[model samples]
Target: MGAAQETRTFVVWDYLVFAGMLLSSAAIGLYYACRRTGPQTQKDFLMGGQKMTAVPVALSLTSSFMSAITILGIPTEIYRFGAIFTMYGFSYVIMVVVTSEVFLPVFYKLGITSTYEYLELRFNRFIRLCGTFLFILQTILYIGVVIYAPALALNQATGFNLWGTIIATGVICTFYSSMGGFKAVVWIHVFQVGIKIAGFLSVIIQGTVVQGGITNILNDSYHGGRLNFWDFNPNPLQRYTFWTIIIGGSITWLTIYGINPAQVQRYNACKNRFQAKLSLYINLIGCWAILTFTTLCGLVLYSRYHDCDPWTAKKISAPDQLMPYLVMDILQDFPGLPGLFVACVYSATLSTVSASVNALAAVTISDIVRPYCPSLSEKTLYWLCKVTSWLFGAICIGMAAVASLMGALLQMVLTIFGVIGGPLLGLFSLGILVPFANSVGAFVGLTTGFAIALWVGIGAQLYPPLPERSLALSLNTDGCNLTSFHLKGNWTTTKGTFSPNAFQDHSAERTALMDNWYSLSFLYFSTVGMLVTIFVGIIVSLLTGGRKQSIDGRFLLTKEDFLSNFDYFKKENHISNQQLDMIEDGEAKTSELSQPITLSTQSV
Candidate 1:
């Protein structure tokens, strides 16, 4: 066993910290469940009565966006691939603007529950059901990785039983989320996000202080090529370029903010459109802060063990284990600190899983169950919502148990997002932006996108090439006085490398379409899928006798949505009256052709 496993133990104070986390979450749930004003109806329970302020909702949105996979996986990413992942923070600005200006107004103004409902309005029931099915698949895959990530990390840090931790966290999150509904989920999120930030900052501070200082950490990481950020390569097969992280990542975030039920639910929970918009900006800031802190944690971990590569030396079993190992290494002597770190991981898991459960429940109730059982009472619908939430939560737990074989949590989550999320995002984009896209086009486009995404996602995983990394900083124990930091006598750095046969494989065909497609960087999955869907959707719609009448201008974010905001530019440019009238007339045609297809109008 490695030192990490040999020395792993949890103290009473650590358990107490974890207990406090669980109890407080349950207490909040119980409190909300008891309030007569709270969760009395389906809308109240699912939508938080539509009275939430910007701050709590913003925090909740932030927590949901950055799950345990991020908390654990990002640091590992930085440690392994350098700080290129940090570029994702830049995409938040694009996400906020697109969502607020384009998507939020549409969802908020329309007063819809499930965002997929908009699909039905713009297209047909087939498209709506397709969108909802994609969302369910995306959330289930994501939440499983989210729950399993921290549990796996905690097991590494404290020697806790992995299955027990997964069950405990999943059951606790499900109970609170089901009982208390959105309000309970939001408040608990606020609390957990606070702990998460504090826990991360503490790690960075302690790690930096111990590693001489921030300057020393940066210098060491810089020398090791771990500070690498810019990659101008336009090749789609190459990972972590500026374009992929920014452009591709923007599409990824748009999927989360624009159409995701978890986020759209928060948008509706707010007091009005303005507050909903405000929460997005707040969430953007939160994303920036968390990414910066975790990036620093990665740098500091590299600095502390500059000469001692954990994975190469077998000091840590996996890259995902890096953060947990770093915490135990640095804070294990300080009794409660290790527990606090474990609690931080759990906090991330709970917030993400709870949010997903709530969102999944909302989608299942609104999109699937209600459509089939129109005669059910609102009260009965509310009970059904809880049952569905619990059911999905249980399924998520089962998925998590199976996630151990999925490799690294972060890569797995992102790949899932690319495969499943892209299609759903394409469906929404088709509805909101393309006025000519019909339901048949959307259904065909979405199916094609999903097929391509899954093929590449699974194929690349099965044939994963050895990931290229720079280990320019060689290992030594000059900074270590502790004997445990030394490599085992039996361990040989050149054990595998010494054999010439290790490099003998040459079966790959570089020119094959399958090879080229599968070789495309994981970051490009969503972007490629989205573009393919849009292109296919447009072609199919036009080829199959597209909409003769314009879609309702309200359903789509046409020029009218932003024309008013850009009045100064239009006026300064001296735009002609004929041009403006043509734009206005087109907008009017949309309103003439479009009709609302809300839940009230549709059969249950």
Candidate 2:
């Protein structure tokens, strides 16, 4: 409120809370590290000896998927755009079904350490290598973004150095993951999930109390058009339509949760196949719950600054800073609450980076290195895993630093993911759905898909065409009562509305290729990439002397997984018919013995 309050520094209590989180995380690592006798081999290091419990694995999956970016970006998106992005909650239903029934079953049954290993089983080592390379690249590129999200926000909110925050978070996470291995990664996630929930709940509860109540928050948000998300538009360029969010979000999540090793590695670590599926459900539910809470926070933010946009007032430099700005505004007098919020952000970042480092290490060891050195000693392999983990952590830190200079590079890399993801995901889908698909077809599809995706992804990025924006929500701070909330600040709200397209003219010129490729919404990137991969793959498979015989039945999805009763009946009826035929043949032989045999003897 005042200058002194504005320049408030984190007190001892604040540092204590933050230090406690770091210590606990490091403690977990130390505990697991001391248990060298427990998981002494590569399998144990990567998959926790395949004896992990369902609940912890579930929590790990949820936390890993909801990175710092998602935690900060979701609320910022909803605040800037509208609540339409909340439809991602509904998209989880489709994601859960596909992963559980289709992807998880195949991967679990195969008992593979890396998701890319399934590519080798279904296709060849080359395809497996390609998939692994793409995965590692995507994860590495993404970790930078994840680390930067919190560091950037913290820098703007509190005078903490951005690079210092990034390095500290990255190094701490890497140490835990490298030493503690898979167990540490999962358990740390469990702890991090708790922190994330507390942070979200605190903001939600405090904001509601400050803004009169839930009833007023909803009324204000509704009138301001911040609560809208029911558009059924089929347009691909439309960002948050039901079709785009459900279809696109489903595909995006499928790649992240279903095929991505960061997630599937947890599935393999579970005690059994059923436990893995249960964890999937748990993760889905947790994801929905977190999104709902965060979305509510977004609405409250809109209510708080309805008339005074943070960007317009220069109260905050970026939308991501709004969360921290809100925290300091409301809880500056409360001492350690601000620190808890930063810890929450850091917790999310740690969970994500740790899981990624562990996963990348697992893939590097199991998919890439181990295959080349099959006879390596177990102890050597275990150490190699740890080394790989640290290597990736260091690489991620470097990438985070580079990300600042390469602004749109993150968007470009993410676009490349859709280009790479569709084919990668489709390769797995082909293995599950199309029995006639051979290794050659899968390989061809993967390469072709990657090439097409690269062309489109890169072309679009180079062209830099702007797509139509989603619906706009107007904000008004005219009804805001700051004094009643016991706050006095130099900052005040402006009544003018913010327009996303204010700078771009509607009649601006566009290149043909830009409209065709660059203008394509990122939401549909994965879906299109997937379709191209499958189409090219199937056609190539057919053209190249298609599969002559059936491959492994386990690789294919069937009625048995979904319709147990139908499979049972089909097996029973087939067995019964075979028995009846045998009986009839025996009866015919007996009849010949009685009469027809006598005639045959006379003829002989």
Candidate 3:
């Protein structure tokens, strides 16, 4: 065991493989930087000249949100909780469908840069500013989590310096994102996603072979209670049940795919509406593929250590470290494979952070900065955009240092999204779907929803659910060879300490109001905030004499637009290729205008 531990440290081959990925990413940024024909315009820098195709954009969409959080956290979630985590795949399918049908058409037709621009068109500047603030907050905090997750995992498994990895990731991502702009970010996503998949596959294929085969893995997991797919418990307080996984998961992801600025920017960059929609469908496949791979990787981890659970055996301190530890434990004999997996994890980080940085720059320029400084030159605005990317990168690095103190990367991220993203999603949905939603309603609804959600989220964090409520499956340490591991006196190993029925007897002891509030599953935070916002926004609007002013039909998704999107083969109903060209051309000609021109009155 000691000899094997010695061999697990990163070697020269590992460093080389990791460095190669960084250099390749940097080179792609440089290529895009040098390839510019002249002074880059706002459209070129922020929108990729509105000429991006379906496939790379689709891949970029996939990579943008697939961050190290999913790579590291999802597997650990399954390992500890059960296979019920895989139920999120159904949520992804729902998210993509709602995004394509409901949200995409309104944004696509308006031909805008920042998505918050729609809020202003539909309501008022105050609403736009509020929406912009929420998005920026949500993204910056989420980037902090993304940057911190893999660094902590690698630090635990390989003795890598944690702060050093965080700084390196932030700096490299900032450099390329600031230099190459949106084109560079999208292409870098395309490049890194391949490496990310390769890294995931290496572990899955190698581990599956080592664990006998798929059947053996399934059998082992099934017997151990890890294959818990049919948990139909209706209690919202219970985590990972079918209702929470499907309903809560769908709303949580919709905040990202449907309304988040990071994703909306990607849709705005496509060549046309059809390609944008196609990119989303392709992204659906990519998301499901990665979800399956990570879920299987969790099962593989269980099969390898089912008899001697690492957390129970004191091999690692936290669940997030399991994947990295497994990689080092099993792949050490294969020289560069461990390094490839590390590269893969960081690749996910780079893709996510770069996309956030780029999206941040766009919103700062379009939503916040430009509205006040409409007279700023195009040249000045372009430079400001790049500088904003750098500024946000620095902020994310500082926040990453803070994220180390937060517990459980996956829940922390989703909680951040729910607390902020839910209200933003509600605000947008209210505007796009409700014709009578006024500025007063928008402002009051957003603030009230945000306050309540923050209270619930913070309360839940301060007083986490009891261990008995969200019990881990049974684990055994009987197979552990204590003689091979130097143990601390305080560390004790027990069999069957955690099981399905172990904690049920203690559930009735908690009855306080705050305790009940805190016990609500983290999955429902988004739903809570969103429902409050929509319900409150409607009530406020009706009370305030809703919508006294006329609204542009282009800003709302009406019945005709909703039904026409389903008529897939209707040539006239779709945005014609010629019309798309005109829209792009009009955007270029009107680039200097304070507000973008509404090119076509027709629905996308």
Candidate with best lDDT: 3
Cα lDDT of all candidates, in order?
0.76, 0.73, 0.82
Off by over 4 Å in 1: 1-6, 469-515, 563-604
TM-score of each: 0.88, 0.86, 0.91
Clashes of each: 2, 4, 0
Cα error of candidate 1 at position 525, Å: 0.4
Candidate 1 vs 2: which has more TM-score = 1
Q: How high a TM-score does candidate 3 get?
A: 0.91
**TM-score of candidate 1 versus the correct structure, residues matched by position:** 0.88
Model 3 steric clash pairs: none
- How close to the true structure is residue 243 of candidate 3, measured as C-alpha lDDT? 95
Candidate 2 clash pair list:
306-475, 306-476, 307-476, 307-477
RMSD of each: 6.9, 10.8, 5.2
| Comparing 1 and 3 on TM-score, the stronger one | 3
Candidate 1 CA-lDDT value: 0.76
Residue-level lDDT tens digits of model 3 in 71-109: 998888888888999888899999998999899978876
Candidate 2 vs candidate 3, TM-score winner:
3
The parts of candidate 3 lying over 4 Å away from their true place are 1-7, 482-511, 565-604
Query: CA shift at 546, candidate 2, in angstroms?
Result: 1.8
